[model samples]
Target: MALKILVTAKRVEDPESKIRVRPDGAGIVTEGVNYKLNPFDEIAVEEALRLKERHGGEVVVVSIGVDKSQTELRAALAMGADRAILVRHDGPLDPAVVSAMLQKIVEAEKPDLVLMGKQSIDDDQNQAGQYLAERLRWPQATFASKEASLESEAEQKKDPGVVLGADGRSLTVVREVDGGVETLVLALPAVVTTDLRLNKPRFASLPGIMKAKKKPLQELAAAALGVDLAPKVVVKRLSEPPARKGGVKVADVEELWKKLHEEAKAL
Candidate 1:
């Protein structure tokens, strides 16, 4: 059967170094924060597109964010997604709650494969994808840095027979593990979150961008999904990390080694 893949993308501010504390200390208003697709999510999208190209299937890119997220969705379309969906919302949400919202989408789409980033840059909670899988009761494989193979019982009657790579069609996954490398392959109808080491995401060319405008984008409101937007976890406060002091450059290896062993506490 052809692949039905649902890949998620997110919009976040570009990486920055400036940090200015707010008057209330509730959050830091970083300067010159430009929005872009989350890096890990871009990898996830690239993985989905590669699989679609190799396996012969459609790739659908999805996102949950405010109206500004459309730009990221368009980028996904330009990168080769057959279609895109934007689930728009206004406020910040806990990962668990976001998972509920995704569950509704997965139920409606009934995709064979779902992909997402390992974590969002803004919160770094990394709980949304796993929670979505749990809610749907589908198999889940997190932090996948490589391609995933799929098989079905329906394939057993075929000529060559289906040879799935270990994880079965239920929840097998091949992912990155510590100490050099290891892969975990899981079953079908599963979720696979990605890491930075995955394939580089593509940029939309001018022609691709123009074509993307003609592509269809289905918008679904969070309330329509029967989910309460209220968050269960409340953030009582937010604060910035302590500032790092400028370090003096050592003139020689001896001084560098001395600094590393003594003041740096490496020794």
Candidate 2:
């Protein structure tokens, strides 16, 4: 039987967009900002596509956001996902709520695996994937990096999908750790959060883009999922970091040394 992989692709601000705190500090000003798929989530989609190509599977991408998130889901489909699901929501959501909603979807979809970004760039909370995994009581692997060493390129290519559990129903994941790298073997029906070096996401060719428009993109309401969408955390204010101070240009090494020793109080 072919594998059923469910991936997540979230809508986020363009990486280059300049964001500012709202006037009332309730949220960030999003007016006139460009929105795109979260970068890490794009990697997640790419990994899912690669796994499907290697293992013969169908990939389904999903997102939780407003109606505009349909565009992100379509982008994932354009990259070769079989279909997409958009959990339409317009208000703020805590990671807990998001996880519960995802759990409800998982119960309905019953996919073999769930792939998502290690963190969302917009908020950088880095909690949704872990929380979702806990809610589903499934194994999880995050910050997917490269294995420590591979004797051959082919071995490296095969590393991510290596099966080590009963009846070839497991996956071995190599991910980055604090000082070195760590490897883990997880059973099937696990959650995997992608990182930067996983794979380069393919651009949507014109043909692919046209085909994506015809692909299945289903929309569902959070209410339909039977999970509370209310935020657990309250945002009293939103603020940007303080402006960086200008640095002085020393005329020579002597001046630089003096400034470092005096102004910076260095040895």
lDDT of 1 by residue, 139-191 (tens): 77777754432233322222111123433354334567776455555568788
Q: Distance (Å) between predicted and true CA of 95, model 1?
A: 0.8
lDDT of 2 at 29: 87
- Best-fitting candidate, measured by lDDT? 2
**Cα lDDT of model 2 by residue, 199-256, tens digit:** 5667878888999999998999989998777798877788778888998899999999
What clash count goes with each model? 16, 0
Q: lDDT score, residue 234, model 1?
A: 75
Clashing pairs in model 2? none
TM-score of each: 0.84, 0.91
In terms of TM-score, which candidate is strongest?
2
Give me the overall lDDT of model 2. Answer: 0.84
